[model samples]
Target: MAELRGTNPYHIKPPEPKVLPKNYTQGVDNLSSEDFLKIYIETLRYQDPFQPQDLSKMLEDMTRLNQIRYMNDMKSFMEGLKGWFNQITLLSSLSLIDKEFVFSTNKIDTLKGGQYYLLSSEDIKGATIRIMDGDDVIKEYQVDINKGLNPIELSDLPKGHYSVQILKNGMPVDSLNLGVMGKIKSVSVSGGELLFELENGELVSPSRLIYAGGM
Candidate 1:
């Protein structure tokens, strides 16, 4: 170590860091197909006088660059398609307002009395219909099943949801749900998707609906 003449002699200078231009970007981060092609040309231009570049390796690199470029283009196209579909869906959902729809559910909205139907695939003479609220039996009624749409009317039930079970041969064979008629009240956006708000305090997706009647 060289001796210093100043009083403070233990200090050492840190090396200055290399600076890049403001527009300079790293090849590893922003490398594209054009940049890669330019690199290939430059490599060929500055090749060795004796030994030359391997043609196979250069072709492999070109192929990889082309594949990456194609994938990025496809990604952009798919993103555009998604945006168009969302726009169409938003426009269509707006027209669904104030329209009444019936979905397959166990919910039944009753005022004085409501009509419920049983769709039988075959003919049957006697089968019991049990209206249930969850595990508890609310009401037990009989339906004249005849392999068709059998309508059943019960006394004024509470304005809520109920499930109907079909009992044949003193045992429950099948179970179906009584649906409620609801009208769309308004629309709301949630997570970039549209939600249909019903008059009965329900939020559902327009895609989930299978049947819709007049406004």
Candidate 2:
């Protein structure tokens, strides 16, 4: 028999160590606090008994988790405060809509021999009032504001149907639809001069008129 020259089967090469891809632990940082806590507990349960986790490392991880939780709470509180302030500002602006004012006009109808007036309780200081008849520019005047009733004369205007406006510093101040009131309910022409019946039931000459309307 020929001597066996075959290589020894017991000389089998050890299996190559398994190689893992890089970035395998990249997603671990995205785990929620609860999930990370559960993973840590499981890792400790199965960790090799001889190589225990360090107490200092565990304390550091817990401290970092607490800091993250506090920061999240602070961010939530700031967001709520911002929402509350915006609501307050909106309510404050809405409060201005309820205020009323009284305004005056300077439009006079010269041919008709009468003047017009407007009455309102809304503030009209620093406003401009314009008077128009059909397509004609009768008169325009600025509102002179005072604490109480303000009087504006419109006797120099032309006679006809007239309209009045209330402005504040050249801008419309209030949207209240003001109505006109006569100095007296009825007027009687006397001495070649037109008279007016004011809403207060007082009879006065057109020249003595201040405002043309009432609120």
Compare the candidates by lDDT and give the number of the best one.
Answer: 1
What is candidate 1's lDDT per residue for 1-215, written digit by digit as tens? 99877322223322333344687543333466798778878988999959888867866665677668657766776666555555556555676788777544555446423345555567766788777789998888776676545555657566666767888878876643344455789887676677888886778876656444432
TM-score of each: 0.56, 0.29
Tell me, by TM-score, which candidate is best: 1
Q: What is the C-alpha lDDT profile of model 2 across 51-73, one tens digit per residue?
A: 98774676567668866865766
Computed on alpha carbons, the lDDT of every model, listed in order, comes to 0.64, 0.51
Q: At residue 152, what lDDT does model 1 achieve?
A: 54
lDDT of 2 at 19: 42
lDDT value, candidate 2, whole model:
0.51
